[model samples]
Target: MAQFDVEAFVDRQKIGRPQLAVLLVCLLVCFIDGFDIFMVGKIAPAIAEGFGEPVEAMTLLFLCQQIGLAVGAFVVAPLADRFGRRSMLIFACATFGAVTLASVYAQTLFQLSIMRGIAGVFMSAGLPMALAMISEATPRHRRSTFIAIALAGYSTGSAASGAVAAWLIDIYGWQSGFWIGGIVPILCIPLLLFFVPESLKYRTERNPKDPGIARTIQRMDRSVVLAGDEVFVLGEADGTARKAKLLDVFLEGRTWMTSILWAACFLSMANIALLAAWLPSFFQEMAGIPIQRFAIIALIAYGGGVVGTLTIGYLMDRIRATTLIPFYYIGISVALFAMGQVSFEAPIFIGILLFWSFAQTGGQGGLNTLITQVYPPRMRSTALGWSGGAGRIGGVISPIFGGVAIAQNFSLQLTLTCIAVVPLIVAVLVFMLGRNSYARQAVIASVVTQRGTA
Candidate 1:
């Protein structure tokens, strides 16, 4: 054999036990990340009451955590290139876990807000690193499907937070939730350090001489033979380039995609953050339901997300994201507007909300997987991190926006309709992107076919 092209090898091979183990670890990490972020929203009412404060007073916690996410993703995610995704994830999880545990003792809203922000600093790292690891480990054709499945853990964890809180909050109060959230991650630290694999790209780039490279190649498939004295990759992953620069995301004909993707992330994350932060309150206030039951509504929404993510992931592999993403946003806009008009009957509102979740939440997974195809491995984590950071800016604003809408006493219908407009605008932007992104699958295919055949 002349040489081994690692990217080409992974793209053309079947995923095995090692890859499956990686996917599960990534899924578990992201699931915990989701659980941590959603936990605050679920327990908001309980914390507010415990602190003797109005719900509006708790908006600062949401705002700060989002700001932390932005700062971490924008400023810290690029460190993965230099430091390794495995190291970054381990550190982030440990720090976030420790801070979360400390939050259990927070005596005031100010203290809790600070702790939440600190937790966010590290929480933002989880998705970027996890996705980077998964993308590098899995084969190209199955990338989206596996990513969707790994991400499904996130939605599941978010839903579990509500159910768990519903069962535990009354008996042990808000602190109980924090205790659970914190301890599990701390426990996960050792597992991550011991078991979670490093990115194959990262290892090869860091040192082409790394023996792990051959092992990683073997792990991707058992059938390949490298009979040559030396093994090396063909192009961007050949260990010659410096991957730490953030500006790389804006180059290589990627300026347009990056810009539009950032916009979509911002709008979608804002709207989703708003719904996550305020919907429970809305259900309790408008539908006159018990507070704990509102979590069931959120759970239903997230359950639809599982179906939605997998469907979108499957379709994007066939249909171009340009067509899929814009239409998906349009569907979310329609579903959300319909949700506003539904009668307060629990089943009906939840069903429509599920439709909205299917479109918007599932569409988000599609965008994430689509993003992986556009950037080479060098740029993947940073691009994902920046897009996540950009979206989190909206997250930072959404809770305050929701608080203002509530404090000003806007009707639920008006609020839902107003928020629906954001996604419609996103649809138009993506439509322009679709026009520019023609033959994207062809580009992705070429990235693979350009490599030599055995």
Candidate 2:
């Protein structure tokens, strides 16, 4: 057997316990983030009834939160590089948690919308920071699996929101869902403080000669290392370290690639946001099922997402992120179209939604992992953040647009089937961009290999 270059392979290889633990924390936070976002959709009917308003009222609230996600990911994540990942996470989580709790007392739809938006500002930081921390901590080769697993928590949380909302509404009220959403994150704060260590890569970059570098490195697991070096020595850290700039994403053949990735994100998420926002309503209105029944279907879809994410993550490492994504989108488009045709039979329509959920939701982690690996560590968080922000734009539009189609009394089949085109277009874009992404990565690898050899 040909021997593998252990160091280059190490970062991309399978990870261990500590890395997984931190990933779980990130996943848990993301889970909460997912729940917060999905909760509104699950409880939309209740919220509308409670506020004595139209479903459109909830759309405004949903849009506000998504807008916050866009702004936070685009604007706030870059700042994390300067301020420090640990500090940013601490502040972000606490703020989001508090705002989420306060939302429980919101007296009107307008007030709740504002509170949700404010909460979004904090929750938005969770994924980018978590992914950044995991990217820095895990070996690059194995990073995708760790990321997929963490994001799985997100899907699971979204799924759980349906059940939880149903139970809470029956017992306490719709407000209880928000209360739990807010309070659960508070628990993460202390876990973040206690168990989740600061990114060693971030610390080393901040001050190579700060005298604390050695201590930080020594305290970390010995398995954690850079791609090529005797070891991750502080002063000798990769000369690639520089002030992370957003502009860096536009340089050296990356300008077009960034745009393409952004487009892919936009389309992929549009459907995701739409489905989350409208599924329960669709089931109630079109399928003539009770809202609680629809919630079960949503849970099934979410479960499929978890499985899809893990499966896709494993495949991405072998097949490469670029190659895996286009097919995933195409699969989602097909599955969604099929979903539009099926009746509410237990195995058919539900199965179609599961397939749609599996492909689309799983592709999310694949896309983010691709972005994280493509960018240099200096700009990794910023790239991830902005990409997420771009996706949020799609998310912002998807729900409102879907709501309009439904409100205008469009047939469910026509509305959902037409929506599938968005992902298909995204699939084409992803194919082009994936090819470009691979070529760029190949060039980067060849250059680095030559330098090491020299």
Candidate 3:
């Protein structure tokens, strides 16, 4: 009887068309996730005026979005552990698709807020599930880069949202942006069903010895599919599902690592949520750029994120994440500080803000990769879910925090200075993490194992 070790096969083999196929489905949904998540913010200024509400009304929408995200992460994401990532992802995608469409006709701001809150719940689950599946599929050497590439879809989605807003919001009204965001995901549902396979590791883990799966793997990679009834699995225990213990994430030697990761996720995500939610308004109000032009500038900023992730993903493969992550955060501080002191000359101002976006969003994406590295397969989903929940908490607070600052009429320097402190804190925490022997050891174990399932 011939046997194939799935874990060894994936870790040893370079990525191929089979793997790329999975990533494509993940990326497409994440693109939809980004649009659904960020679209409300994109239309905020217009919606505020349309409803005869103060601009700060956007704050409620942002809060509801995060609140939903927190519930999704803390409450919903871990369900993937028992239910499987593919199922959770498809369900979330469908749920958000329907909710986003329903949200367009929400005549009252309160109704829109409620709808967005629910969308956030589903939106929150999309990325972590995609990351887990991608991580499981990728080879160890290419894990960071591949994960970053897939995640780049998200930033691209945000950039696309800016483009849509610029084009549609100006003419058909903000509702059109909502309409576009909603329709695309529903359209993708068919594609997801037909094209995207369940996580390979997951299927093998569930029923490693199944003859059908062996044939599927045979089709996926003929060389790895050994003949006969002998089929084998790697990086996972036998077929019985591993139920997550919530406390297990913090227990074991992972206590400090969990805390630090949560802290880092919180601060970095707060920075991202704050900036992404408010930047267009910032440029429109402060720099007096027209809404359409400012939206394009915002697009440039997020587009820089695509570049940042691709670049950083390459560097992370060579450089230590400990050293590299801290530097990225430091760069974030420097860029924010620079933005404050610089004159609003379009060229210089736009350049600084773009770099700022590049640094901030890239650094945040790194945090996502870092989570995959920090946790092993068994607890990975749980760790990501909770830390993501923490990030959502930060997301929940950021807009309100920024709103209060703006309400008090804080200078851009003062407002930004306050926001800049988060990454600076994250930098210190990252460096301290770098110094920790336990963290270094766990990270090494996860990378070397590369089973990437839980």
Each candidate: what lDDT?
0.77, 0.73, 0.76
**Local accuracy of candidate 3 as per-residue lDDT tens digits, 359-398:** 8777887888888776655556677888889988887677
Cα RMSD for candidate 3? 3.7
lDDT of 2 by residue, 20-109 (tens): 768877888878877887788778888888889998778789778878888888888777777777678778888888998888888899
In angstroms, the error of model 2 at 309 is: 0.8
Between which residue pairs do clashes occur in model 1?
A: none
TM-score of each: 0.87, 0.85, 0.87
- Give the per-residue lDDT digits (tens) of candidate 1, residues 204-234: 6556666677876665566767654544653
* Prediction 3 global C-alpha lDDT: 0.76
Between candidates 1 and 3, the lDDT winner? 1
Task: Score candidate 2 by lDDT.
Answer: 0.73
RMSD of each: 3.6, 5.2, 3.7
On lDDT, the stronger of 1 and 2 is: 1
Off by over 4 Å in 1: 48-57, 107-109, 219-223, 227-231, 234-239, 280-298, 346-350, 399-414, 437-454
What lDDT is obtained when candidate 1 is compared to the true structure?
Answer: 0.77
Could you tell me the lDDT of residue 40 within candidate 1? Answer: 85
Residue 424, model 1, lDDT: 95
